[model samples]
Target chain A: MLSSTVENYLKSLFLLDPRGEKEVATGELAKSLEVTPGSATSMIKTLAQAGLVEHRPHYGVRLTSQGRTLAVHVVRRHRIVELFLVNVLGMDWSEVHEEAEQLEHVVSDEVITRMDDLLGHPSHDPHGDPIPSADGTLPTRTLQTLSFCNEGDNVSIARIGNQNTEFLKFAEDNGLLLGRTITIKNKNEIADSITITTHEKEVVLGLAAAGKIEVEHV
Target chain B: MLSSTVENYLKSLFLLDPRGEKEVATGELAKSLEVTPGSATSMIKTLAQAGLVEHRPHYGVRLTSQGRTLAVHVVRRHRIVELFLVNVLGMDWSEVHEEAEQLEHVVSDEVITRMDDLLGHPSHDPHGDPIPSADGTLPTRTLQTLSFCNEGDNVSIARIGNQNTEFLKFAEDNGLLLGRTITIKNKNEIADSITITTHEKEVVLGLAAAGKIEVEHV
Candidate 1:
């Protein structure tokens, strides 16, 4: 069995290069994992030796197909666990991510499958991130951020790009939840803020916050 | 945070000396943990230094009050996870022990508390083992095994003392479930077997199997 540390590394690599289209620099990997470059390089070498990754000297590293398979399973476990914590256990969506990180490595596949069944085989988690299928296939979709929506455009919240607790709490407080439809009231380029109407209430958000919220046209 | 190994040792000690009234031999601890006596002694010394156990060289060791509290919490996690797996996930009772063993080490306290509420604060798990309360209190009750019951005694299955998968599967096959009431129709001492009636069907079990089933008077 892979240690949680190894699983975390693989998952991070998958997230960094979701399409496996390019190699990720060791420095970037270290920064993402909050580990020293030396530690990341050492682990990358180990992964290379195990044929889970291909390391290019002075370039970076990319996961091998075998590594990608394992990484996607970890992602599947993580997203499924997050949804289970929120939907089944009634935990706040903002709080479930931290809990899911610890659970993803330890939860058995059987239990995860059962949870998936109980959840009616959901395609997306609470944060609107796509859940990898049981067979490790991840569905990809592109949505525009709220900041990019045109004035007077009606849209539905698709996903939250920023998952930080404070950001999620703020979004929740402002009623910016997944699948909630709202009209783009105005976009002030000079002020770098966007105004939107939800539940007959107009709310203004800074461009930075608006950019983190992905939305789909109604 | 205690490593899972440390938690396992502490939990083993608690199981071997539930009342914490007597010192347990290193050899016994080693046997229970399937580890060498040398390894057990090494860990015991470490635990002693941590003030979690009182160790006497050439004799045995026992948990301190502080150690007992931590041990009970691990037990609580294990039992709650087991019950959650069985009741919520719809897993077979005979198969959930191994899953719970891994999950108990990594699950967050908040998640476990939520699961406890979901399970309605169950006092006993699927196998009828008592679950430690959230505050580290364990309820103890004494009951007689079926082997000691007199012929014609009407009893309800309170707990299954044996947790082995094969034994539990056998019990389930014979409809010997928790809270199931059965009549002790006969005890053949010479044959070393006991005959019980459940659901108007007479089933015979070896004396050893009967000894592992704890029951209470109906």
Candidate 2:
């Protein structure tokens, strides 16, 4: 009977350490979840006691394999629901993330599977995030952020690292989307902005914005 | 900010008195929600304090207009989700009721409206229960339990009063579905059994089972 709050914690931990490589500092998790340091510590202790997380005194915490499984399932539900909301309901991709956050916790696994099948087993959600497989594995795709691409490089957008609705809307408005080919025209290091051409339209994106858009070299 | 448990309580209250009529006894609500009388009394007090319900000590409780509005919305979500699960997802009708119970509390109003439109504004769910309109009005249809119908009366199944999965499955298997016209064959009052003929098939239903099937004179 994991509450949605607990599920959110597990998902956040998985997102912070996708490969389960190392311990994630408490302060880092606190920042990620936007909770106070005190609250994060208490919650980490609770998770550790439940065997969902491993905690070290004065160090950091990491998810156990049991916790990872639950987190992946939550991610699976979220992506499937997001795709369903956008594809089936004709909702805007910008608005589906918040709706999926609430629904992912309550929709039965049966419903998620139905949605997955209905959407033809989509590998990516509307936001370009991989939908975890039913068996709890995520599809891997190597990509670099637009900010890291060299000037004059040609790349195809592979994913959007941010789920912020406003940012996503901005990206969509400027023709930044998964699979769109873009040619880096200029990189101004001091101004922290990069210039790119997509389908002959020149667009200038700030460092923050460019970093949020991951791309694969073409 | 009401929890799903609180929403369930409000929904139970609305079901106990859909018309917002006279006060509903605490014991009746307790029975409907399968909670103990003491718990029901405490919950009613909490609701009364929150102004969603008016509790008359030793008398009963009744929903305020604010509460009724919220409850109606919950009911609307429940029926819409149930219909969506069955019609769109091709899920079993017997299983959808339970799924809708959890979803009704969490699905966003936007999602519900999309479902309502996708379903082409269905008036009733698969179980033959009326779906409350968005503005909190229910379409009225007079109906009575099959147990109350006289022998030799011709009736059309209007709705199923009980949402029990096993009973609903049995009713479905026996062709006791909404809008199905059947002729009363015989009634054995002492044995508490009633016989009906639908199409060319004759079926005998127990008093309890018959009571759960609502019908209208054809």
Candidate 3:
């Protein structure tokens, strides 16, 4: 059985380049894991030895066919668990990520496959993150950021970049969730703030905050 | 946040002494974790620093009041997940344990408390293992072993020691689940196999095998 830490490394590596199907950098992995460069180096060596990660100095890390499959499976398990927690268990979307991270490593393939079937091949989790198919294929999507719109352009909040509770609560406090439509009203002359209209409510967000949200045209 | 490993240690300590009100032996904990005595010593020290365990030399380890509470909460999450898997997800008993172990450390207290309410305040898991109440109380049960019965004695299979897939499939093939009655017809002197009658069929099991099964008087 792979340890949760190793499973996380694999997932992070895959997430870095879902289709790069190529090598990834040690520095990028360290940033993702928030570990010391030395520690990431040591772990990558361990993972390489275990055949979960293939490292090439400047080229970065790549999941071998075996590693890629495992990463996909873990991602699939995580998304399914999130769906189970929210759609069935009534847990808040923000709370499911940590819970799913812990469960994805322990449940048997049998349980995960069963959960996938029970969830009816869901396309995305509560946060609007695409759930990879059992075979590692992600549904095609063309997502745009709320900040990518011009004044008076209307769009739907397709997803958010953050799943942290504080962040989701912040979004909720501002009336953001999947399928919530927002119209960009205007941007400040001197500052980066952008104003938006949604659900009969107005939200004033800075440029960085506006960029934190992803949206799709209505 | 407690690492699942630490939670497992606290859990093992608590299980060693049903009353968290007592001390546990280091050797006992080592045996439970299949770790060396030296490793247990090191880990117990770590746990103590984390305020999850208190060690009193040869008397072994005990949970701090805080640790005991955390252990109870972990166990409650575990059994509630087991119940959810069995009752809601229709997962087999054999598959719930490992999943519950992973889930226990990750799920929030609110989710578990809600599930406890949804499961009708179940007193036991599908395997007849006592489910700890929200108050950390184990319901009193007076279950006995099926093998203890003499010839012509009738009993219902209350639980079994093993829930591996092979065993579950074996039990299922023999039409045994909770509430299934087994009446001992006779004992073969040579093989020590007991002839038993079930709902609509009769079967024989070796003495050692039947001894592993727990039962309740009908």
Candidate 4:
């Protein structure tokens, strides 16, 4: 019976090591969890003692198989709940993520399964992030950030690297939504800006913002 | 913002003083919360300092108007979530109370409002317990325990005073569900049992169990 805080730490570790192949730095986990590096180290130690994580003292920490399994289930609950809140409850997509953060810890697996069935077993959430299946299978999709594409290339939005509600709203307002086709118009490397044309409308995104928007070739 | 523990304490106080007119004994509150009397007293003191309850040492404690308002909202959330779990998710009625206990503390008001609308502003839950309105107005209806009804009287089950799943399952197994009409066949006062007939089947219940079931004259 893991506390929600412990579940959250495990989730952060899972997200940081999506491929489950590398040890993540304490600083990175701290930044992702919005906690101090000292706090992250303490929590990492606790998780290691519980056999959920392995702490490589001078390096960082990585999830054990047990930790990864628990983390996947938590992610599954989060994505399924987010989809239900938006599709069934008609909640704003930008807002549902925050609500799901609290709900994912409390809803039973039975409820999540019912929600998955109700939503017709969606493969991805509204943000285009893959929902880990009940059996812990994550989707393998080849995607590149918009910042990495050639100026003349055309691509479709796949997912946003950021989950911030403000960032999501900004993308939505500019028609940078998932599955929207966009042609790269110009790239000013020195200025750190990328210009794209979507549906006869042109929008300029900062290099940092463009890097956050992942895309696939059209 | 009150922690769920504080909220639970407040809710217990509210339920113990349904009429909002009397001070409930500390021992009774302790029993209701399943805590020791000393712990109940300590918590009552904390609640009193927060201005949510008034403590009368050697007597009891009562909810302040502020406490009652918050307690009613928590009740609204609990009943609405229970109805949603059973009605929308197709969960068993006997199972939803436990699930709702966890959900009520986490679901946001926005989500609850959506559920209320989806359920068409239901006034009563599946158990016939009145759901407090969003504005905190609890329905006023006179109801009495089945143990108080006279032998030969006909009544319809209104609400079950107990939320224990086992007790509910026992009632369901005996066809003693909410809204079921039954006629009192006999009352054995010394033996502490009441016999009732429902749908041509007769069932005998001890006074303790009968007292947990509220009914209305049909």
Candidate 4 CA-lDDT value: 0.92
DockQ of each: 0.88, 0.87, 0.51, 0.86
lDDT per residue for candidate 1 within B52-125, as digits (tens), equals 99999998999999999999999999999999999999999998988888888989999999999999999998
The local lDDT score (0 to 100) that residue B32 gets in candidate 1 is 89
Pairs clashing within candidate 2: none
Once fitted onto the true fold, the runs of candidate 4 whose alpha carbons sit more than 4 angstroms away are none
What TM-score, to 2 decimals, does candidate 2 have? 0.96
In terms of lDDT, the best-performing candidate is 1
Off by over 4 Å in 1: A186-192, A200-202, B188-191
Q: B122-197 in candidate 2: lDDT tens per residue?
A: 9999988899999888988889999998888999999998888998898888888889999989989999999999
- Name the docking class for model 1: high
What lDDT tens digits, residue by residue, belong to model 1 across residues A1-218?
A: 88898999999999999999999999999999999999999999999998899999779999999999999999999999999999999999999998898899999899999999999999999999999998889888889999999899999999998779998998898899999999999999999999999985789999999999999997
Among incorrect, acceptable, medium and high, the docking class of model 3 is: medium
lDDT of 4 by residue, B15-102 (tens): 8887798999999999988999999999999999999999989999999999999999898999999999888999878888888888
lDDT tens string, model 3, B35-65?
A: 8998899999999998888888877788988
lDDT of 1 at A111: 90
User: Which of 2 and 3 is ahead in DockQ?
Assistant: 2
CAPRI grade, predicted model 4: high
Cα-based lDDT at residue A100, candidate 3: 86
Q: What is the interface RMSD of candidate 1, in Å?
A: 0.7
Q: Provide the global lDDT of candidate 3 against the true structure.
A: 0.82
